[model samples]
Target: MTHATGYAALSAESPMAPFTFERRALRADDVRLDIRYCGVCHFDLHQARDDWHNSVCPCVPGHEIIGTVTEVGPDVTRFQIGDLAAIGCMVDSCMACPECVRGPEQYCVKRSTPTYNGKDRMDGSPTYGGYSDHIVAREQFVLKLPEGLDPERAAPLLCAGITTWSPLRHWKVGPGSRVAVAGLGGLGHMGVKLAVGLGAEVTVVTTSPAKSADALALGAH
Candidate 1:
């Protein structure tokens, strides 16, 4: 067993404490990462407190991971040592399934393996997450960190950026199109940024007028 250290809540309602556990050794398709800075998203709270009823005890919580690739499995052709990479909210999935075959494991009809607090399909052991010093995951789940972007700021884009891609594209909005992004939370902020990036005139709808300036400051037009 590979040893690892992370912060974890011993039980629901308890503060996260130091934790040590075993990580599975590298497999033919695995990539090992030396985790850099991980963003603390608000969902951390929900998962820590069992708000969604998906909490796994000794829960080590985090998914937005930006790191340097330290090792790659023999069959991993996409990345090599010293390359910057990212692990999002997913780690593994049954590649034989239709969704996996299409290259969108997030929509895997059999359900993709989530980053943390998930079960490993092969070993039947619990999978932990990115709130740790390192992670070893199958190469398919790793996203290449763009050289142009700052990894710290780019971390949230893994989960946040992908969620808002649909609504904007679904409406076929483009230059001169008026778009409305509701709310100002993490996901909402990503929505505003994306809409503006796509050349849409974006107005963020918020019950709190306090967020109006923030929305505008974040590139919402």
Candidate 2:
């Protein structure tokens, strides 16, 4: 086991405070990462506060994670030590399920293992998250940080970015496609950028007329 330190909410009413925990020893397909940046998603706040009524205490909540590959297990082949990498909301899943094989592991029939506030598939140990010094995850759930993207700015892409990008890509949004992003929030802004980037005719639908300039600046028509 590897010792790790991070901030955690000890209870629903508690503020995040320094906490220490153990990361499981490397499994053959695992890659260990030294965390660099972790995006603060609203889900983290909700989980920390037990707003969903399902949070575990000492919840260390963060899922948009960017890190450096510090070590790779014997069977790991996709990453090398010192590579920039990332982990999103999921850490593992039963890959034999039809959903997993078809490509949406989030719908894994056995239920995908979340990055935190979840039970490890192997040991049933409560999984801690990326607001930590280091983390161990299966290589299948890790992504290679693209070479030119800035890690700090790219962190949100793991969650907010992908959340919007997936559907845009699924619908084959492209030149001549009309895309309407609903707001200028985290996910909305990303949707606009992605839709515009994909050559779509993007529109930002907002209740605030003052945001018109901001929306236009973001490439929304």
Best by TM-score: 2
lDDT of 1 by residue, 1-221 (tens): 57999999778879999999988888999999999978787787788888899889888888899999998889999999999999988899999888799887888888888888889888978888889999999998998998889987988887787778776888887899998888999899999888888899999999999999999898887
TM-score of each: 0.95, 0.98
The global Cα lDDT (0 to 1) of model 1 is 0.88
Off by over 4 Å in 2: none
Cα lDDT, model 2, residue 175: 97
Candidate 1 residues lying further than 4 Å off, grouped into runs, are none
Per-model root-mean-square deviation over C-alphas? 1.3, 0.9
- What is the alpha-carbon lDDT for the whole of candidate 2? 0.96
